[model samples]
Every structure is written in C-alpha cells, then in structure tokens.
Target: MDKLTSMNVFVRVAKAGSFAGGARDLDISRAMATKHIMHLEGVLGTRLFNRTTRSLSLTDVGASYLERCQQVLLEVEEMEAAVTHLQTEPRGVLRISAPPVIGSTHIAHAVSEFLKIHSDLTIEMIIQSSPGDLIDEGIDVAIFLGALDDTSMFARKLASSSLVVCGSPDYFEQYGIPETPEDLENHSCLVNWAIAPRNKWLFKGEAGYTGINVSGRMQANVADPIRIAAISGLGLVMLPTYIVGRDIEKGRLKVVLEDYTSPPLDVHAVYPHRKYLSAKVRSFMDFLQEWLEHRVSVIPPVME
Candidate 1:
C-alpha cells in the first residue's frame, strides 16, 4: 500500500486497538492489516505496537505518531472537501469531543436537530470530562466552557452560564442558611474538581467577587453527581446555573448567596486552525452556531 493507505491503516489500528478490529472496520483481512503494519514499521525502523494474544497497544512513539498521522489525514480530507464543495454536500463522519454535561444537556440536542436536515452526515461524539486537550485528542470540533489559553486554536463563542451556590431547601433549613461568603468556612461544600481553586469557591456579586475556601464532606469532578448530592441534601454545591436551573425552579434545590454569584462562563466551539475545513466540520459548526443562538443565556459557566 502507499503512504496514505499505510497511515490510514495505522490510524485505524491505533483507534481500534487491535489488528482484527482494524481489519473489521476497514473491511480487510487480519493478515492484510498485520502486513501493512509490519511494512510501515519496517520502513520507519520502529516497533509501533506491543501486541499480546488478545490485545494490542501502541508503543510510546507509536502513540505520538498516531496523533500527527490523524492530523495529516484530516488535512488531506479537508483538501478533498474543498475540491468537492461545489458539487457535493457536507456528508461525512464528523467526530466531536465535548465535556459530558455540556454534551448531554445541550450539544447532543443540537446535533440531533442538525442531523434532521443534513441526512448524509454522521457524528461520532466522545463525552469526556473537563480539561482534556482537544487537538492532541484528535477531534474535529470541541464544545466547552471558560478560558481557552491556547491562541493557536480557533474558538467561537457559543453561550454563557452562571455559577449557583445552593443546596436542598432541607439542607439550608437545617444549616440555618449561609448569610455571607465567610459563613461557608463552616459549611459542607461540594467541590467540582474542574474549578482550579479546588477548596476555594469563587463568587462575584455585590461584594465585587471573592474566593471562599470551604470544607465539605463531598467533592466530585463531574456535575451530574454533584447535582445529585445537592438534591439529596448532601451539601451546598456551586454549579453552573444551567445545570441546576430546573432543580431550583422545582424546589428540589435552593439557591444561596445570589448577591455574591460569579459571572457566567463563556461556552465556545473550538477547532484547530487550518487553511480549509472539511464539509463535516463546516456543516456541524454552522448548525451548532445556529443552534447556540437560541440557547444564549445570561448565566455563568458550568463545571466544564
């Protein structure tokens, strides 16, 4: 096989995690997959994989090479999209990565609506936690919140969400309610690990913003569980307003320190900067942009 085919085989094997799996995905024989990998490794003079009887994994160098190879392959796909843009519609697999909560609460719905009209498009979504490296992870588009420090990537503002400091009404009633940020020092605080100051919850409002280091019996990295804990009267959790909106409205949870709430987190659709975008990427982005315009909120950023 040629270099492009070799790279394709390598990426498929790396993603599939086994020669048999890659062969199944590519509709080729396991023997052919093994031969292609062997040829590529021989040309490169490296052992790309460490294989066992039942499993396969990339070697350290192979792990790094797979990232670069996927980008190169994507660039080639983009070139093809540019050539076919006038004659063909955006119709291909668009891989997306997003934080679990955001993907579940919002993006998934938007993607479903998008697929209604773009019938030829396919979507592969990975629901990951916050603080994941998007480009190295090999995704076409990433939906996330807060500050994106990397200037090399492109980010488009999608929406905003506010942070809520609250708990169940029963919990507040039992704890006698926290009258000020300083009161949180003795309160049970549920921490979201995605927030940098793990012990200190940030609040912004009439007092011009402050960080309160809190002690709690519960802490988690994801919002779903945090919400559950708060609803069950576990403790006061500082979560994005969007995540806890219905809960608060339904009296399942209560909002506290509203006067000291922080500003909203800006949600963005981020992608690697490139000369051309594949049809899959372009269509997905356009659909997302249209969908986001409707969900624009004045609230603060969530766990992502």
Candidate 2:
C-alpha cells in the first residue's frame, strides 16, 4: 500500500473514532482499515488509538501525532500546488497589504526586487492602519507584524523584530534620557494613533511586565508623521526598532531606555488558501520569508 494511503487511512480512523466507522466513510472494509492502521502503527512502533468495547479514544502520543499528521498533509498539498504554480509562469497582479512601516521599508523593497526577476508581476500595496478579515476582503496576501494568535489563519513567522525607544537629540537634551521605565513619565511620550489601548506604552521591567500611562500633545495614526514629529524633536517615540533604526544610526534620532525594551514581535506573511494559492501570492511569500529572516536586522546594539 502507498505510504500516503496508509497514513490517510490512519488519519481517518483516528478522526472517526473507530476502524469500522473509518471504513464506512472511506468506502473500505473494516478488515482493510484495521490492516492499514496496523501497518502504520507497526512502522511507527506506536499505538495511535486505544479501543474499548464502548468507546474509542486516542492516547497521549496518538493525540500529538494526529496534529502533526494533519500538518504534514497540508504541507504535501502546498508543495504540489507550488510546483503547479511555478510551472504556470504566474502572471497577474499580486495584491499585498501590510503595516505602513514594514511595507514601505522592507516588504516594498522585496516586491520591487521580485518584480525585477518576475517582470510580469504587478502589486497593489496597501499600507493599512489596521488589519482586517482576509477572507472577507479578497486580499491575496497580508503581511502582518507581531505574534499571530489568530488560529483562523495559517501564520508563517518570517522574523523577530525588536523595539526601540527613541527621540531627537534635542528632545532628550531638553527632557533627559530615561534609564528606566519610571523615567518615561518625566518626558513627553509620542504614540501611534491606531494602537488599541492607545494611551499605554508597554515595557519589560526588572520586576515584571509594566504598562505606563502616557500623555503627549502630539500623536498620529501612522509611522511617517510620528517619525517626522519625533525627528523634529517634538516628543519621545517607542517604535519597533526597524522604523527608527536607520534614523538613530544616521544621528537624526537618539536611542534611549536601553534597559527597558519590549519583547520582540514576530513578523508574519499570511493569506487565505483561497481554494489554492495563486502564483503571485505564493512567490511573494517565499520572497518575504527569506528577506525577513536574513535581510532585515533591526536590532540596535544595546544602547550605550
């Protein structure tokens, strides 16, 4: 029997809760289903399902293996689709959405480079203020920042992005550098306009996690404006390190709060299966996964 066929039979048995039920569903006899599962168990040397007279259940190992089995199946499907997509010479518009900072800096660069190679591709890049339902909007691909807790989507983590607390030299000169989380209150705090719980800036403190209530006269819904304001020495900004990293290095902005950086956020490229992935989305995701993992290094040296 084919390995995939046996695994498929085993998956059905585990899911349906009985060999008899699995056979009925797969249109095979119970004896064949038993043999198929027996072969799979013998090969792996683990009992996947525990059977009793009244009910069927999976053992601890069986439970864990089932999830892995499902993931393996999805990967196999994706691999086949990828081959098909590549062979088809993927020509079409690739619509991409991401947060403004990432889209403008990293993703946009990758897209431009990708177009150089696959010249037929065109992209509609939307720098979103917030994320939305991909399934609802017909969005081909969504480039997302931060750890994804959305179980509804399949997330491929591209990289870990760090945070930076920075202000203009003038702002820090006037207000002073904050060596600790407590010092943030003494200085003006600039914030992103769209962040939920907008008034709070998170920090990792010596004791544990802490959130500081911030008050600043200037705030904006996007990165460019906030960055412009910060560079002009208006107020302090706590941003993902990538956004201000170049400015900080160029001496346009000064980094502060070395001991109090937030935990890294995982950047991800996500999409709806959309039945099957088009060549455009698949190709770009492959590109982004590489770029974010290797190309972008936004972690600033621990502030001196």
Best by TM-score: 1
The C-alpha lDDT values of all candidates are 0.80, 0.77
What lDDT is obtained when candidate 1 is compared to the true structure? 0.80
Tell me each candidate's TM-score: 0.66, 0.65
- Tens-digit lDDT track of model 1 for 1-304: 6988988999998899889889899999999999999988999999999988887889998998899999999999999877787235777777788887878867888888888888878888888875357668778888877777778788778777777798998898788799888998988888888655678887765657678888788778778887898898889988777777777767888888877767666788888866567767777777787766556463323222
The candidate that wins on lDDT is: 1
lDDT of 2 by residue, 7-107 (tens): 77878888888888889989999999989888888988999888888888888988898888888888999998877866466567777889877787788
In model 1, residue pairs whose N, Cα or C atoms come closer than 3 Å (at least 3 residues apart or on different chains), thus clashing, are 161-299, 161-300, 161-301, 162-299, 162-300, 264-300, 265-300, 265-301
Worst 10 residues of 2 by lDDT: 295-304
Q: How many residue pairs clash in each candidate at the backbone level?
A: 8, 0
Worst 10 residues of 1 by lDDT: 295-304
